[model samples]
Target: MSAVLELVEFDAEGFMNDAKAWTPEIGEAIAATLGITLTNRHWVVINFARKEFTEKGEAPSLRRITKTTDVDTKEIYQLFPGGPAKVAAKIAGLSKPTGCI
Candidate 1:
């Protein structure tokens, strides 16, 4: 975990325990820990994920992310690599999405 993450409360899986603890800088730190560099495209997904979590009380699924955002499945995979929705939710300081393992 990054120094920034150390300052906040995270679950065993590195998801933030309190979504309010998140900041843009914290998101960057989380991405760095995952070996990702935030791009404009990344921010689009991150923002959408956070907004969805705030309004809906759960992380958005990969399908929802693809449909609502400009990013598609392939691009999301290219951007987030391992598990697009999972990684994006983590960086956005949200719990794992419903369908993610």
Candidate 2:
């Protein structure tokens, strides 16, 4: 059976305060709020961001994402349009990037 996750409230930057509350459905909702449609390509980045956060206890940096993931910086920027790391991370249900304001 699939788990049902409710729509969560996001912080000002659109990040969910509780990572455990996140789900694929919630990710889609968050993406919609940012005027984004979650494509397969977008999922690659989102999944990567979640993995990084799980292993590192912080959001993944764009640099690390590009270097480690199959996608490059150009593709990621095009996928997310504006604020790729910040936006994608938020949609991935992670906190704001450490250095972002």
Candidate 3:
């Protein structure tokens, strides 16, 4: 957490405007706010998502997550509750993924 960037600055959806400032501690804090505990399964999805965003400049879709990361949509939903892509991205400390409501 930076001296300046407060978690409240993030959107209602919990995405920060300056995603580059994201850190694992921030991610954990965001997840706690969202009522999600970071599990190893959750970490796998988050890591895959961040990697996809870095390589493709876009967050991977639910279908993409299933197709590429070998994580099925059902498991994703279980891991993220609410909206998987959006919640997961916020917890991953990335920008709100495109095409996610």
Candidate 4:
């Protein structure tokens, strides 16, 4: 299976329980910061981004993410330094990147 797919298979409870890493609080923070309610769509994007990062060891670009999520690229870039990939990665509980992933 693809690395992305594999990453998607990660245990959500374990991820949320990691105090030093992905946590439920962090997810809540991201949702509030983004001014968006956490829904199935958000989960899909988060999981997809995590999968993409795991498969490539890097985040997907804004363009690709926009196409996948149908969210505005400019809006995402305004919210995240690099773009949706960066924001999505964070929401997915991935470490921040030094630059555009």
Compare the candidates by lDDT and give the number of the best one.
Answer: 1
Worst 10 residues of 3 by lDDT: 1-10
* Clashing pairs in model 4, backbone N/Cα/C closer than 3 A: none
- Between candidates 1 and 4, which one is better according to TM-score? 1
Candidate 1 lDDT, tens digit per residue, 8-68?
8888997889888799999999999889999999999999999999999999999999999
Q: Taking the tens digit of each residue's C-alpha lDDT, what string does model 3 give over 1-101?
A: 44434644677655776666777777777787777888888989989888888888777777778787867889999999988888887776677778745
**Candidate 4, 3-96: lDDT as tens digits:** 2223232244223222235554566565555565566656766666667767776556667677877666665655454445656665666655
Off by over 4 Å in 2: 1-7, 99-101
Question: What local lDDT score does residue 52 receive in model 1, on the 0 to 100 scale?
Answer: 94
Q: TM-score of each candidate? A: 0.94, 0.87, 0.83, 0.50
In order, candidate lDDTs are: 0.92, 0.83, 0.77, 0.56
Task: Return the TM-score for candidate 2, rounded to 2 decimals.
Answer: 0.87
Model 1 — which ten-residue stretch has the worst lDDT?
1-10
Q: What's model 4's overall lDDT?
A: 0.56
lDDT of 2 by residue, 56-88 (tens): 888888888898899898899988988888888
CA shift of 45, model 4, Å: 1.4
